[model samples]
Target: MLTIHVVSHTHWDREWYLTFQQFRFRLVELIDQLLALLDADPDYRYFMLDGQAIVLEDYLEVRPERKEDVRRYAQEGRLLIGPWYILPDEFLVSPEATVRNLLIGERVCRRFGPKMRIGYLPDPFGHIGQMPQILRGFDIDAACLWRGVGEAPTELRWRAPDGSEVLLLHLRDSYSNAAWLPADENGFVQGLAELRDSLAPYATTSHVLAMQGTDHTRPRADLPRLLAAADARLEDTRVVHSTLPRYLAAVRDELGERESRLPVISGELRSSQRAHLLPGVLSTRMWIKQRNHACETLLERWAEPFSAIAAHLQPEILNLKPLVDRAWRYLLENHPHDSICGCSVDQVHREMVTRFDWCEQIGEEVTRRSLQAIVQQINATTPAIVVFNPSSSPRTDLVSVEIEPPPEPDQPLLDEAGRIVPYRTLGRRRREFFGMEVDRDGFAFLVAQFGSTGGRVQEQLTFRHAEIAVEEGTAHVHIVVSQREGARPGPFDEALEQAQALLTDESIQHYSVRVVEDEGVTIQFVARDVPPIGYTTYTLRVGATLAVAHAVAHAVAQKPVGATLAVAHDRATLAVAHKPVGATL
Candidate 1:
């Protein structure tokens, strides 16, 4: 007998053409209806939450009152939630990010219910090579996916580079194949026949899967009745509501002895023949990719290691793990297939910038604090430069250090040993501090430079005035500014007029001052033997030298009075003679 497992699921792209908040409003309505159906109808069986745990958080954020409803449905084996935080694009993010995605997803899902064990990747552009091994490490033995595979049977073994394999289930056409199953008796009969005939040829066993929903779609309210009609009308076929896990279990039982004979496919699945890979997303909105890599590097390479070192050296230091995790969460929010792939609408990508900013800000501050904590225990009275190497290999590289009070242009630096360090001055620059007093003209220029209007800087007087500081205990109001690329000089005219108008209106009646930049010298010196995952400190010494004496060599060679030249070739002479028979030379 043939068994048709109808899996009801909605492939939720959290943010695509619509911004997250906009799509979130729709999600609220979908879940509200889903909870009602699952509560009222026992035969609805199961509804997959797009194989992600993040959707639950998104849902609960708006429907806090429905927490128990979600918990009840999930715990009762009727709602399949997560083995992934979000279905991320396999190639865009770091391998570590992928691991964290699963690791965090598993933890969050298990809190209220049983987590799905299958690697349920319904829609990623392609699958990665090591995915099987990664899933196996997490105790997952099966994977279901929709794209990036060529012509093959529905069931096969996907192997990782390390030889670990998983039972791979291919969604041949799409996850939306059975999205509109017929409701009436005649329509059901026709639909089941077509589905059975279409899928049976590819099935390794007598079971075939029919996914019953599409993107952001609610479950069919009368799905149970529809399945019952098909079951009764069909001959020698059992059509029932089922989930992916149960279907896979039945397939395993059927293929018990024939499992080894299943075809094995390995490595990354990025073929474009079966489905479009959307490869351009890798290069589109490239700034987003750049910022993402920077944020990941800051947290993983710098903040994390320093925090670990500080925690071990100074137990009394403030705990930074919470802050670090928060930053990581912010970063991961942008890792979804649609979000990080840069395939979403303008507003969706725009919101990603703010999240990246928050993540980077938190990571930078945490790294600075951790290093400061470690520096406090260094037991040095004079100023010193601390160079840290966060990689596994020892480093020998030049490091730039900004010196206060402007050092001599040719000043030599010294290490812990009394040896002179080879150094050169890159140049000097004025580092302006925030909240510094500036004249009306300078204030206007700064405003025009940093502020942007409509996400562009081409128009004058268009940028919004973000902030203006009125200083206390000083006769000056502070205007903070930083240099930005593509900012023009003439746009400051309107900003100047606005600042003057504010001053005349008594907003800064008592304040009148001019800004002056501070001078600092930047010097580069070679840092040697910086240990892996460790730090080295260097000191600047004035007029310091080693006591060892050096001897000078005086030697020269004179050309000989007579020169001789010699050339050697073969002693025997050769003649250009041709010895050919029929062929022309």
Candidate 2:
């Protein structure tokens, strides 16, 4: 007999085109009614809350009194709450962010009741390659997700990098399987038939996971009666109101008998997948992407380890966990499919930026506390900064510290034992201090191969920023002065001929002096004088060398608009314009 588990749910986006408050009004109503139905009617077997915990948070924010009502239902195995704090875009965040998201989900939902056992990521853009390992780390062994599956069957063994595997189900059409579910008995009969027929090919087992809701959907209070009516019209099928775990568990059994019939998909979920899940979103809104990386680095690389070490040293600060969790909540809020994917409306993204700012602020403050605690106990003799390797295991790496007594630009910096440290400038802040060489307290970046203790030195690294000055789209030539020049062709004419031949290539760094018709405006090509982040602007001025100026080739053709010609300081000035559309020049 065919068994169909009609999983009742609502795909809730806390904020999308509408603001959170606007969406909350609908969410509050939905949850209020859903809660009432689950309690008022004993027949309403179960209801799934969008495979997320944010809906719970949003619900509690407005209807704080109904906390137990929701929890009671969850504890009874009649409601599914998590697998995610918020349904995040799988591609836009770091693996650590995913781990933290699941951690928050598991932590919060456990307070209410038993959380959803499966990694029920129904709405992420695409699954990452390492998702199996991540889920397994959280002790979750299976996942049900939609998007990024091409012609493949819904059931597959998705493997991770570490060879760990997950039982994955990629929903074919959508999580909204029955969005246009029929209201009348006759319509419901036809709908069930069409749904059954439609799902036959994708079904390898006697069970099918049926989604009975759409985006921002309500609990469809009379779905149980409708399923009962639809079942009477069917001959051999058993239609029942059920949850995902119940359905997937049954399907898992069916698949076990017919193992070879299903496909095992390896690696990530991005490919010639059905809908493509709109892959462009990965690179969209790069400003947000860059900021996200920055904040994530601060939290994952610095703040977290620093806090862990601090907690190891001081047991008193353990109470800061709730505050840290709040910070993480804010950061995770920014991980929603639309929010962190950076494809939301301007208002939504603006709110996201503020959330990020909040996370960064808390992260910075926490990190500062940790550092202050570490640095305050230093017993160094000379000008040295106490540094800690945040890694748990023994590590010896290049350590950089900004010292108060700024060293001279060329002076070698040393440790407390008077050891001369070889270093390069990473950055310097021009603040004057009382004992500084330049009469200012500017901080100097002193990098060195410092051993953590008596261990081996490994992984020498430095952060360097270069300021290259080039006009947009313009190609540049660099000549190293120290490189021995080709023996200068002993004869003058041979040298001149050789120079002429070399000058033909635009990349050739041969000396070129164009006097602009010798109007006293000399243009020299200098490879040695470029500053960081500086640009060389080629302002064309009208001069006697009209033919020479006209022949100048640009990286991108810049046409002379109306030939605006003038002379400044005995120099030819030519005003060039950006390449105009449909213009050959």
In candidate 1, which residue ranges exceed 4 Å CA deviation? 408-411, 429-519, 546-585
Kindly report the root-mean-square deviation of model 1 from the true structure over all alpha carbons.
18.2
Query: Alpha-carbon error at 450 in model 1, in Å?
Result: 42
* lDDT per model vs. reference: 0.77, 0.65
Best by TM-score: 1
TM-score of each predicted structure versus truth? 0.78, 0.70
lDDT of 2 by residue, 397-434 (tens): 44444543333222333333333223444444332111
Tell me which residue pairs clash in candidate 1.
none
What are the per-residue Cα lDDT tens digits for candidate 1 across 168-198? 9988867888887677778877887788888
Candidate 1: worst 10 consecutive residues by lDDT?
Answer: 548-557
Candidate number with greatest lDDT = 1
